[model samples]
Target: MKTPWAVVVGEVADVKENSPDLPLKQQYYIPDEQEAEMAGSLGSPTDIADNGGYIVLRTAMAPEQMENLLRSTVHSIDPQLPLTQVQSMEHAISDSEAPRRFNTALITSFASIAVLLAILGIYSVIAFSVALRVQEMAIRMALGSQRSGIFRLVVLSGAKLALFGCGIGLAGAVAASRLLRSFLFGVSPFDPLVLTLATISLLLLALVASLLPASRAASVDLTEALRSE
Candidate 1:
């Protein structure tokens, strides 16, 4: 009867290095049944020796079981050799992915907080600026400035501030992105698409922040504003 198995082919040096001080009989393979049956009939221990390779019996075994078997086999063969850096393939794969996942999570969290703070800061600045400019806005209205014009002026001021900040931020990001190259996977730190999207988003947020203030400015009553001053 044929037993199913997985063939684990690695460099001889790697196998020896990973499985030092192990005996052959204690070692087992996750076998391919078809190949094992074809090869098993041709070899005794002496015949297997002339082939410069070893065969493993395919049986029901977990990864841990296979690992233990291989370690024991190596130890049986060479008791003096030390087994070092022994690990399951699954563990190696997980170790490889851990750093990438950590970096992604950290970047995502920082970006979220930065965006939230930017929106809040913009909103507060525009609100305060509009409040301070109420007297000036009333004067403009009294002097025949159109509501639309006042609105445009307020929005333009906010846009100018946004553009200035974004320009500086873009430069800083470009300079800082180089340090993050190791953390980036598929996307470049200096990606044009990312920069363009960020700029557009920040500008849009600035516009939104300024809108309420602009509307308030435009709706200011010349008589009431003048009387209050």
Candidate 2:
């Protein structure tokens, strides 16, 4: 049911291809000449391109040298022809990702700040608990419990809280990551590697935050702790 170019319209075969900048659905592929004819028929200028096209080149030589060679070759063929935006594949990909990189940096900064605040919060909670239990700790030490045991006990408490918090956070993250799918590339929103790394990082930070309070609890002066009660 087409009125354009006089060519046989054969049954279409599905082909799967991916482009980072373009959608994958409802795409057509035709010869350059045929596409030009169709564009002309649609009242568009076929003599000149509105947007420039790009060429992909593979070479064993260095990119800078290849770019120079390409420019010289193009000039030799047509002195009037001008090539703009000549760049290596790496540069092109990086340029395309410039905005994405900025977004990622912003997200990372916010996430870092949030993690810092969480660590501080954990430290505060553990420190307060240690202060309140000073008498109990003094009694335990008097009854032959070692300072190292007190340190271990305090650290284990923090770890248990961290584990519980991480479990809940992971659940929320799995739900929230769906919103981030648009910003991510080449990785799934539910990527196991990323989740594992985040969990491990948070747990380690929690342990670190608990360390100072644990140390203080272990070094508590028995007289001061007993008198404070």
Model 1, range 154-225, lDDT digits (tens) per residue? 999889889988999998987888777767655788889989999999999888888998899999988888
* Candidate 1, superposed: residue stretches over 4 Å from native: 1-95
Best by TM-score: 2
TM-score of each: 0.59, 0.76
Backbone clashes for every candidate come to 18, 0
* Model 1 C-alpha lDDT versus the unseen true structure: 0.76
The window of 10 residues in a row where model 1 has the poorest summed lDDT is 13-22
lDDT of 2 by residue, 1-229 (tens): 3456656567576544433634556656566677676656454563535456667799999988998999999999989888999888788778777887898899999989988998999999999999988888889999999999999999998998899989998888878887888887667878899889999999999999999999999999999888874
CA lDDT, every model vs. true structure: 0.76, 0.85
User: CA shift at 183, candidate 1, in angstroms?
Assistant: 1.0
